[model samples]
Target: MRLSEFSVPDTLAARGALALAEQYQSEAITAHALRSWVWAEAFALVDGITGIDHELLYVAAVLHDIGTVTEFDNHTLSYEHAGGHVAIALAAGAGWESERRERALEVIVRHNWPRVDPAIDAEGYLLEIATGLDISGARPDALPREFVRDVLDAYPRGALAAEFGACVVDQAERKPDTAARRLVDGGVLEKLAANPLEAR
Candidate 1:
């Protein structure tokens, strides 16, 4: 499968999602989100995950962490849930049908899951694994080493480790019941700190 087919979607919602992510998230987070797209697309190409909507993955990648921003943060909701609701609203405004809007929500909400059955939601499963690869460098051999190098060179991780760490830590402090707390208490910081991608 050629990788040329996997790329940022040119749809209205995709553009809006990127714009909103840039407007609301810090630069590190925005780059992290975009890197997640690159990772997801790369994974899809290698794994031959065809026939799905690339636009949905792009939208999910860009806005999956929007709730981490102060503007969208929810005290009672996990960041992914907050981000999913925000994505659903944006999708509706972008003229998506109800099913597509809901699917976008599913992709964003499940991006952090440890596992998502690909038969049910390929985009979610892709995003979950992609974000894992980006954030913690899980399954490093899944993608070509040269491809990973090109992507990191193009996007650069910047201060993602520090920036995202503080954000999640803050989220944990405010919402002890959420996944952020679980990640914090489970030593996700150490994982991020030790992530292979963090190196130049």
Candidate 2:
């Protein structure tokens, strides 16, 4: 959450997404618009995620066009490749530990597409969940039953464990949709193409 821990470029990317989100909120962006903004913001945030080298993951999430941007019907493959490219680029930039960068790339590669490694840790799991959540575009009040179903389907076995799962569910149930919306604005998409993650 803290920007101090991230690299300059990472920080800039996050700030750019934030500005876009704010713009969308003010304009009362529609659900589709908000979904786009959310994906961009989520990508920026994922880029700087702590305890995980998220540069590649962020790129994957940002470019995870589920029939939105690219022509590919299988967004899973698209996201994997996009993330892989980002990882390669970031590695070339020499901003992260080589081993960590490799692992990050691996995580992105396995995120949705079928791979030998299906297991994911907390950060990766969270990224997957967040990615699905953003694409689903489930508003607080309008959370389709299918949204929950899909989340459950994706994470059939609760990694949070029973007690933790209960707590997460409880919190989610109590938290208003508006609160989640406030986390990121609805206008993020339009500005994402232009904004920089950090302020120059």
Candidate 3:
């Protein structure tokens, strides 16, 4: 799809995603510098996911962290608390339907670690994996082997899921620290260990 097709018109989330992506690409920002950038990259992988409204997922991913800009000191809690307000404002500003707005808000709120429900299964799964991938940075040690295994087992043949996983691995490998590299390398090794029945 054309990038513009994914755009949420006149919304801060949309603008912020683009700006953060550009900043990262230019090396003008550290991974830490662009909290939204990491969120958007993870979101883009969600965009590549199928069996869902890619637009809605993309929009929700972008807006998920809007609360971070204001109350970054406790981002996770802040995001959980403030996500609805930010989502409501942005959705209304963008003229989104109430259903769509609510769905997006739900995704944003549940995007936290150790996700809350399996009912919104796909979105929740994506959010957990995406959040793990983003926080892990170019190399994430935070995600344990069991978590990766659980996610993989749950979505074994999903193309979008595999793509997202691969992106996390690849990005992690590109970091400067040997520790980060080791984490990525080790994570893959651990994944293989956990799922010996599966092919690499």
* Candidate with maximal lDDT: 1
Q: Cα deviation in Å at residue 54, candidate 3? A: 1.2
- Which candidate do you rate higher for TM-score, 1 or 3? 1
Whole-model lDDT, model 1: 0.87
How displaced is residue 24 in candidate 3, in Å?
A: 15
| Tens digits of per-residue lDDT for model 1, 56-102 | 88999999999988899988999999999999999999999999999
TM-score of 2: 0.35
Backbone steric clashes in candidate 2, count = 5
Name the runs in model 2 displaced over 4 angstroms: 1-60, 63-79, 113-119, 137-200
Query: Model 2's lDDT to the true fold?
Result: 0.36
Ranked by TM-score, top first: 1, 3, 2
Compared with the true structure, all predictions reach lDDT values of: 0.87, 0.36, 0.45
In candidate 1, list every pair of residues with a backbone clash. none
Structural RMSD, model 1: 1.6
Once fitted onto the true fold, the runs of candidate 3 whose alpha carbons sit more than 4 angstroms away are: 1-49, 71-77, 116-119, 137-200
Better of 1 and 3 by lDDT: 1
- List TM-score per model, in order: 0.95, 0.35, 0.44
